[model samples]
Target: MEGVVVRRVIPSDNSCLFNAVGYVMEHNKDKAPELRQVIAAAVASDPTKYNEAFLGKRNEEYCSWIMDPEKWGGAIELSILSEYYGREIAAYDIQTTRCDLYGQEKKYNERVMLIYDGLHYDALAMTPVESAPEEFDQTIFPVDYKRSIGPAEELALNMAKDAHRKRSYTDTSNFTLRCGVCQIGVIGQKEAVEHAQATGHVNFQEYR
Candidate 1:
């Protein structure tokens, strides 16, 4: 793990799942809500592509629900991120110490990790090897790593176990944000994002 560090996005936003994966996939937290929309659209376009146990609702209904910015991404979003983006998603459930690998399971070369603390999911990505954390002026994604990197499935599991024991992943509802335009504050990152989706004017920078 020399020459590498795990990328992290905190605050327990409802977008942690997407934000975490996006940080690895796109290297930006802002694209998280947009990523949710993309996955929802993907699931809507192909109802048969996903497993029933994870669908949670009728295909169309679930698709619509997932598009809501307030909705938290879970197994469904993880699957979509893996398949649509063509990367393996190694999700570690801290409670069970079990790792669920999503993607083609054979063909996909790149991979990302999602930690499931039973009630919440958090993204964990290793920093690129060649670059020093403080040396980089701009963040890069998994695909941007020009050099080959080996899979660290066991490493991901260990990290999740440590995080779970440390209570690193908290329920996202505890975050609060105040809108810049409307000057209205909302509890939970979900509510703040939903408000932004509706008004398109809130500056969620005023985090509480």
Candidate 2:
């Protein structure tokens, strides 16, 4: 009896990365705040390693920014969390159909999967059946299990291709957005950033 690999959708609350990671690690989706703190604390503890140059901001500023619930997490946060958890974190990107392995150099004995569809993150799991619930999901995979791991990777690739075909990703460079604060329409990332800076309005909603 073989299991099916599937992507478990996480909420779009700007904390999808943390939630996806938490779900795969602990079967808990509500650990965003705690995980955010973990990254902040790790950065604060090693100012020399995560310096202003490396972080694109002051260490204290990065720490403060990460603690904000509205802030999104990315590569730096993934790297920090990977070291914190002592496992390889593989993010399968739908746009590129590439799996970016964080902590791969450390040769971690275990690995976890996440689906990254350009703007959002989702957890990847293997279950007994296609429609099995999260409770029956096996999110963690031992690095040595090539036979099983191959299926998971294949599944992720196929999912990514499907998402690509459906145009299910946001091209930040050329997307329409409406300011949630004032309802002003903006085009693309450049206008959005300018609008935010000028109006101090950070909330934005994308539309087709």
Candidate 3:
């Protein structure tokens, strides 16, 4: 696998981070108790402050565990708090350290890497934007139509209208939406809005 650039966890990175945590919990059943404790401690801390610090520092000391398989047992969990569409959202998750354990000739590390990979793939599938369509018409008006608003404002207005439509119609309420490529359930307008905010698509005009 190619090396992944594990960027600093800004507040906007929470959803992905949380998805990573869920991936670990679901797939890494054999993770060490001590390791789990460390992850839990990090999650239990103030997410806003911790995420800010993590992003601000962007240093090895702050992110070494995420890159070192031996230190945090190939996985590290963290939280990101971000504001999207004027709403605060939290995302947390455990990420596998990118290392070639088999190449390193460490049997234990190799096993851990396999387990981590399983979780990572599963979590990726579960991400809210994993299955989102890309070609949906987001423009509410025709190109030739006269408009007084910018693209961002138009998008917000469209989102509000879609929210109202979803809230009013039961059949539409059951529809699923995607953020990027991730599929998300639409329980109602509020949930849809939350999902949009969480996935950094707050001003997206696409109905689904």
139-207 in candidate 2: lDDT tens per residue?
A: 888777342356676776788888888877777788999999999999898999899889989899998
Collision pairs in model 1: none
Estimate the lDDT of model 2.
Answer: 0.88
Q: Deviation in angstroms for 131 in model 1?
A: 13
Q: Compose the digit string of candidate 3's lDDT tens values, residues 1-208.
A: 1111121111222133333333223332233343434553454454655563644433333544343332222223421211111111111121212222121111111011111221121121111132333222121111222322134233333433443444432232344444444654355446766876577554322254
Worst 10 residues of 3 by lDDT: 106-115
- Of the two candidates 1 and 3, the one with more favorable lDDT, higher being better, is 1
Task: Judge candidate 1 at residue 153 and give its lDDT.
Answer: 50
Which 10-residue window in model 2 sums to the lowest lDDT? 144-153
Quote each prediction's TM-score: 0.63, 0.93, 0.20
State in Å the error of residue 35, model 3. 8.7
